[model samples]
Target: MSIDSTRFILLNTSHYGNIGATARAMKTMGFSDLVLVAPRFADALVHEDTVAMASGAADILVRARVVGSLAEALDGISYACATAMTPRDFGPATHAPRPLFAELARSEHRVAFVFGSERFGMANDDVYRCHACISIPTHPDYGSLNLAQAVQLLAYDWRQALGGFEVAPRVPDASLADGAQVQGLLGHWQQALTDIGFLDPAAPKKLMPRLNQLLNRAELSAEEVHILRGIARAIQRRG
Candidate 1:
């Protein structure tokens, strides 16, 4: 089956440099129509360093759309897979790179591949959102991988899957979390932290910063943020 832009997605990447590199790689594979789902580097733009890495596909960087949530990022995607270095309890047993690639080769539906951040991999809920798991095989002694490395690897396989077939037309997906939804979640998170003694009003110095870092790092999707807010409200009620 031929590949289309709709069959792929990159999620929660934290660096502009990496995003640029990813755009280049996808373009190299003859895939564009990239959707950034609440990437940490939401302010990213086409810069010299990124363009340098993108090489021939620098234009893809300019055309990329940055959205606020994974669900929005993944809207209309028929199949979903999370790329993780480690398997989690909530997800299916992981697949090695080639096997996952082979399976993807067989499928005809739109697929999305999610890559988590540099530090913690995809969260439990995010993994649950995927239909399968793809893991890059690395040295057993040092299994960690950089974000761009992971994206390039998957994109490489997808390119192979295309295998001389012309790529299809682009179809846009919906955004899962709009601005208002994410803001509401942030507000609830802030309130919950304040109410739970996590943020002391008398010395509201370090906590807000740390909370901001955590919330920002999470790259919370609209649905995820709302769900988290609900959990926060539940916790507050119990307290």
Candidate 2:
């Protein structure tokens, strides 16, 4: 299933923060089609708490659709999965998110994950309408989940099944010190240690070897080697 074709649907959501948090969750997972089925407040799409919780995903709230009913929200969607605790006597077969999502990944279905209100979960009718009811495994004593948290967990699992995004580091990786550079730095530090009276040449023992092991473990970068050499120069000047 294409991430672009997936939608997150919320029914009768009572808090603006939930709407905002949902937008943030969807954006992080590379899914953004959001639909609200008769939310408690008309301004929920742009409420202060919603915007605040959304962080930087306001574009999702702007494109989100508000509909009168679940039918309207699922107009172009081919599949719907209810994120409600399965009804004891009735409703569709309950499935765990990861396995169901893996199965869905092969199909071309335009899927939707439907969530219910915070106070009361989806009604029996809502669970019955969905193709599958997803009961996120939680502690037996408490399975209650925050509306945004459920959406996030479901979205994350689905995204992983569809193939996750590549992680990138914020800063460019520094060039590591070559063997020669590390040796040079070690020699400089050894001199500085002796000059500072921290290491005695007659009683050197394994001090330099132990320090060399520490630097090797640190994986010092070329720039770090230069900095250490500079400190060694300062110590020599002081002596």
Candidate 3:
């Protein structure tokens, strides 16, 4: 699927902030096309809530269009996917985003992801016409999702199928504590626990083994080992 050819269609959005937030979400995933199908407000495209939510992605909103109907919104799209729960009976097949997007990525289809309004989702009639329904798996107890959040998730998964950007570390990873450093910390901790009578050498009873397991699970850094050793020293002094 062409990222440029993909557009997000919000159907009858009631909340204006969601419109702006959706623009921001689309921009982050390298999607630019945003079409609103009959938003509640006439000036939704330029609404302050939309602009404020767009943040650095104001360009997306500037290029966004407002349409009267889904048919008009999907004018040039080859495949349209509705974002909603699967129809229990007989409608389009419902798929999770990743697998569906991966399948779509193999083709040159111009896809549009249609989202329903925040209050009431898309009509069954509207969903029946789509090629497939895309459902983001959520807890069975509560599946309610914020509109922009759903857009962000679908956009991210679709972008991943199209080869996402590599993550760059903001800071270098911390140096890990070597076995020798860990052994030293363990020895120091042993002394502290023994002095405090928390562990009796005569009747250790798996206490040291349990502490070892705890530290091993912690996956300590070298700096953390040194800090822990200092605490052990303090404990011994207090004892």
Candidate 4:
């Protein structure tokens, strides 16, 4: 697999400093594809603060692509993973980036690891679009990680994976669902749950969240999402 096919996407990044730091982190790990999805500051890549933070890796900031949405950023990517600490009901299965990278290294398709804004992390909608979620192992009482720190960890893993690092004997045989497919499946389920009176949209407490967790653990593939959505449609019609 070409290491150049791997992308590091930052979504709704608010601080130019973080952007710069992220650039440096990626460069240190030999990753160059940097895409910023709707950063808070339009001039983040060129800002003085960003330049100052990037230090020696300003070349990455200069070449970074800025886009309007996550979908746009992930247009041609086959596998997309989200990095976040907050557990979700419908989120992808959480894995350490290292093993995930090792598996990804065997694939020829384009891949992306998306990180949310420093302030709020990724939105549920954005997280839903990813094929998997990565939670950096940390202390239970304090699991918060800086945006750049997270990038560095994943980038390092990808670099190692490219260099033939294997934590296990073999990667699993599975094709993961992309963002749009996952979103459609979730939408179908949401409607079905509403029709069945299983989810009160007005006061949706933990029902959908619980279901998200369940589905994420299932690691549904595209075919599986399609099948599940079919079942959801059936439930909608029956109700």
Candidate 5:
């Protein structure tokens, strides 16, 4: 029940925002201990950008421990879990985050969740040092997640396994975009395609409808719709 005993170790973190976001994610889930192993920026934890990105979780950043090596980070850890999506011929067996957290939740000993650099995940030796590997179940074609997102997912699952924390209710009736919004997105895509010469308006086949169907199936949220629209605008600008 003492989640504080579990540490969140970040190795060679290259981005200040990621470090800050990781702190926010850990604090949101009630986990505090953070260890950074030779981060790219020596003062990332205290950087203004990092503090800004941490939102209201700056306390975690203030108390974060920095070490010169992974060994130092794992000094007192009883069990360690490496968050690495890639498979290795040798090393700890990869387990999905939920089940792994469920098992770790029962342990009273100190535990650590180890994450690696954004460009490349944990080195083979580091992965080998862990008792287990945690891979968040993601689409096979696109399994890559940002460093902070990965931390958030694992933190959320681990927190849930530890009886979970209360979160505020979402706004009522605020969900994925409705039909009109989808259509608008499709229209934007159509113009973008035409502007980029990807689709010939005169000789257009069923491509637009097909794309519309694909978008509909995606159940895009309002934010996603806005992102797609922004992409379309970018395409138009470039065209």
Candidate 6:
């Protein structure tokens, strides 16, 4: 029930303001360690709309990490659930929130609840990554939740899991990669991409910038970054 150990990841957010709002939502609930997967606005959020939405939760927004794929985003999670408006093969739809939190309370595992973009929920392959799905009930006619609102709902459940306990001192997530290691992996990724001819060497103008946007947004921990770099190296070795 310690909130620090749990991860609430947002996948493919398009708006900087929503990202900021999500950050604010988490912070308001005494939760931090929010992760964004393939966020559309990497640069624009730094200006102001995001900060304004964060309000007092600006620090959480500042500390957010962005990553590329859902697989990579959920790299270290032991228990994963994808939130959806419709249910899939693994589980039925959740019209209520308490039972889900009740399940979360019983397990001492490291869990991550993944939310997809507003435009499209989650892909079938992405849903395959999770053990189940969480659905927030609303008026059956119009139950869709805004991105930030969805995050707020999950954050509230996480708070309940803690039994209203005071926010514990921030402990580093053992799963995330350190900054230096992530930097090295980024370098390796660029080099590998160029080696594979995915990037043009001479005309590599926007390539690094794009890579920076992708990698920097992840803010990957040392461990996660190395795991990813290892995959990249393996691919190169295999090729």
| Model 5 C-alpha lDDT per residue in residues 83-198, reported as the tens digit of each score | 88778998899898888778778877688999999988899999999999988899978888999999898888888998997767787654799899899999999999999999
Query: Model 5, residue 93: displacement in angstroms?
Result: 0.6
Error of 2 at 47 (Å): 2.9
Clash counts per candidate, in order, are 2, 0, 0, 4, 0, 8
* Residue-level lDDT tens digits of model 3 in 36-138: 9999899998888889999888899889899898889989998999987646477889998999999999898999999998888998877876899999999
For candidate 3, report its TM-score.
0.71
lDDT of 6 at 20: 82
- State the lDDT of candidate 1 residue by residue for 125-168, as single tens digits: 87888888887878889977777777777778777765644667
Over the stretch 103-203, how does candidate 4's per-residue lDDT look in tens digits? 87787768899999988998999999999998888898998788988888888877888893446647576688877887778778888888998889999
TM-score of each: 0.62, 0.87, 0.71, 0.67, 0.69, 0.64
Instruction: Give the candidate number with the greatest lDDT.
Output: 2
**Model 6 per-residue lDDT tens digits across residues 39-143:** 777663475887888888878866777788888877778888788876666653443667877777788777888888878888878888787677777787998
Better of 1 and 3 by TM-score: 3
The local lDDT score (0 to 100) that residue 177 gets in candidate 4 is: 85
Q: What C-alpha lDDT do the candidate models reach, one value each?
A: 0.72, 0.91, 0.90, 0.87, 0.91, 0.77
Off by over 4 Å in 1: 5-7, 164-239
Stretches off by above 4 angstroms in model 5 are: 167-239
Highest TM-score, which number? 2
User: What global local distance difference test value does model 5 have?
Assistant: 0.91
lDDT tens readout by residue for model 2, 52-142: 9999999999999999988888888888999987464776889988889999988889999999999888988778788988889899999
**Candidate 2 segments exceeding 4 Å error:** 196-214, 230-239
lDDT of 6: 0.77
Better of 2 and 3 by TM-score: 2
